[model samples]
Target: MSEVKKIATRASYGSALVELGKEHDDLVVLDADLAAATQTGMFKKEFPDRHIDCGIAECNMVGIGAGLATTGKVPFVSTFAMFAAGRAYEQLRNSVAYPHLNVKVGATHGGISVGEDGATHQCCEDFALMRAIPGMVVMSPADDIEAKAMVKAAYEYVGPVYMRFGRLAVPVINDRPDYKFEMGKGIVLREGKDVTIVANGLCVAASLEAAEKLAADGIDAKVINIHTIKPLDEDLIVTAAKETGKVVTVEEHSVIGGLGGAVCECLSEKAPVPVKRIGVNDVFGESGPAVALLEKYGLDAEGIYKQVKEFV
Candidate 1:
């Protein structure tokens, strides 16, 4: 094994916007007073005229992005996950999803990894909220590489898109040159027959590590990275469940109405199996370091390993 490179998905999001901006002239960026934090400042610096600062009003920012979309502009809205998905959910529902506009919402600081920001800033239910909207494309990239690729893919995709990224730096798991991000498709990182671990966003790396731990114990666990949550890869999920007869879903969001809920919903309808969900167990987050928070909430590699062992 070699030393892996680590980078924040938020940083990758900023650079992805700058890279995509050069190609798409209609691409416009919007932020609500936290461009620096969300990393949308990179786009603002490069394309000043195309960027809009809507102050601290997240709702107004989303509305502005919706309005821009109506005029044939591709607007990428940026803000914290709490505000983008919670505060401005109404505007997103009406202005963006209702009309099926071409708006890309970049929600950073998603999940408990926001660290010292605490419960208020840490959004563990954005995935659930966003996925409920009709015609909404929801995505949570696993790492920087996937984050960049998803950003570009979301821009090219029509209608509304909600992309969640984290503030903490994570190891680059998909550094292979052959890697390509396809919308609504889940990528299998490792193949096994004992169990299947389906994970997204920050938990993907953790799940990979858990798989390695399981392998050492003679438990061959399959790892699947679901970058796109909505329009989830149903075939993949069903196949994994049918093949393994056991399934585990890991996420940084709440166990309710998040990836776990989505997986259970799919399995119940298609292939019923004993599924274990690893995430925040219907509780609010507290102030702590990002990694510590993950550990306490049972969202880390060790936590996942324990949960999977118990589940099996």
Candidate 2:
């Protein structure tokens, strides 16, 4: 069997920006002294004049991005999730989201997969924070293809957008001819009637693998990749929940107010099925190897498989 290709969503974000820069002259990129880490350096290298490094001040960088947007420029503010969504949250919420600017906040290194960077850097609450802002589009890509497509989509769609990317290289699962990318829509990867596994980001691939394990055990699991958190594909989730009678949401974020929370909120009112949220359970992550941390936190394929098996 051929080995699966893996690439970090952060790398995809950088490459996608370069692609968009070529097509749109008004597309500018701003970074908070994390161009290299956030992969915005790719854009800076291509368009030095359009790229702006706002030093280490994430808040000020957001302000600059917001200002640029007012002049009809689509600015993508790049930084670590901790800084972009956590540190500069006030500026993003007020300056960008409040006024509904055409600014994209590219937050890389989200969740416990940030590895040795530890609790301070790992931003598991960004989804919840971004989702709270009215009219803000929140998204997380599952692989390189989806990440690139999503970046372009965000640029084309005018408004405040928050996109989360992971440092860890994940497998390319959506490289099929039938694959499509649509904001606020869920993709059902596998069809089954036993239970529904709705996941996003790194967790989508893990959940797919877990579904395979479940299949081996005669537990048919329907897997859905919900890339968009805000303006979530509630109809898809509700339909899946109604068919399966049970739902399991997985994400590389805290269970509180992340994908799990969003799923629960949708189902409680519409479907009201039994749910199991697999993610960081309201606890801070410690410094550890990224893979090891995922295993420890029950975000790995084996962990998700075990949890889903028990739930079923």
Candidate 3:
């Protein structure tokens, strides 16, 4: 069997920016002195004039991005999730989201997968924060292809967007010809009669692997990739919940106010089914190897499989 290709969604974010820069002269990128780590250096290298380094001030950078947007420029503000979503929350909520500007927040190194960076850097609450903003579009791509596609979609959407990317390289699962990307839509990767596994970001791949394990154990689990979190694919989630009668949501983020929370919110009102949310259990992450932390937090394939088996 051929080895699966892996690439960090952060890398994809940078590459997509470069590609979009070539097509749109109005596209600009700003970073909070984290161009290299956030992968915005790729855009800086290609268009030095368009890329602005705001020197570690996340709030100011967001304000600058918002100001640039008023001039009909699509500005992507790049930084770690901690800074982009956490540190600059006030500026983002007021300057960008309140005015409904065409500013994209490229938040890299989201969740516990940030590894040795520890609790301070790992931003598991970004989804909840971004989702709270009235018109904000929140997204977390599963792989390189989806990440690139999401960037394009965010750029075309013309409003505030918060895009989360991971540092860990994840497998490329959406490389099929039938694959399609649409805002506020979920993709059903596998069809089954048993429980439904809805996930995003790195957890989508893990959930898919967990579904395979469930299949081996005679549990036909369905897998759904919900890349968009703000304008969530409620219909898809509701339909899947009705079909399966039980649902499991997985994410690298905290189970509170993330994908798991969003899924629960949807199912409770529309399809009310039993649900199990697999993610960080509302505890701060400690410094550790990224893979090990995932294992410890039950975000890896084996861990998810074990949890799903137990749930079943």
Clashing pairs in 3: none
Q: What is residue 123's positional error in candidate 3, in angstroms? A: 1.0
Clash list (residue pairs), candidate 2: none
Q: Write the per-residue lDDT of candidate 2 for residues 1-312, one digit (tens) a residue.
A: 128999999999999999999999999999989999999999999999999999999999999999999999999999999998899989999999999999999999999999999999999999999999999999999999999999999999999999999999999999999999999999999999999999999999999999999999999999999999988999999999999999999999999998999999999999899999999999999999999999999999999999999999
Candidate 3 to truth, TM: 0.99
Q: Which residue pairs in candidate 1 collide?
A: none
lDDT of 3 at 155: 94
If ranked by lDDT, best first, what sequence of candidates would result? 2, 1, 3
TM-scores vs. true structure, each candidate:
0.99, 0.99, 0.99
Candidate 3, 143: how far from true, in Å? Answer: 0.4
lDDT tens digits, residue span 1-312, model 3: 128999999999999999999999999999989899989999999999999999979999999999999999999999999998899999999999999999999999999999999999998889988998899999999999999999999999989999999999999999999999999999999998889999999999999998998999999999999999989999999999999999999998888998889899988898899999998898988899999999999999999999988998
Give the Cα lDDT of each candidate.
0.94, 0.96, 0.94
lDDT of 3 at 271: 89
Runs of candidate 3 exceeding 4 Å displacement = none
25-60, model 1: which lDDT tens digit per residue?
999999999999999999999999999999999999
Answer with 2 or 3, whichever has the higher lDDT.
2
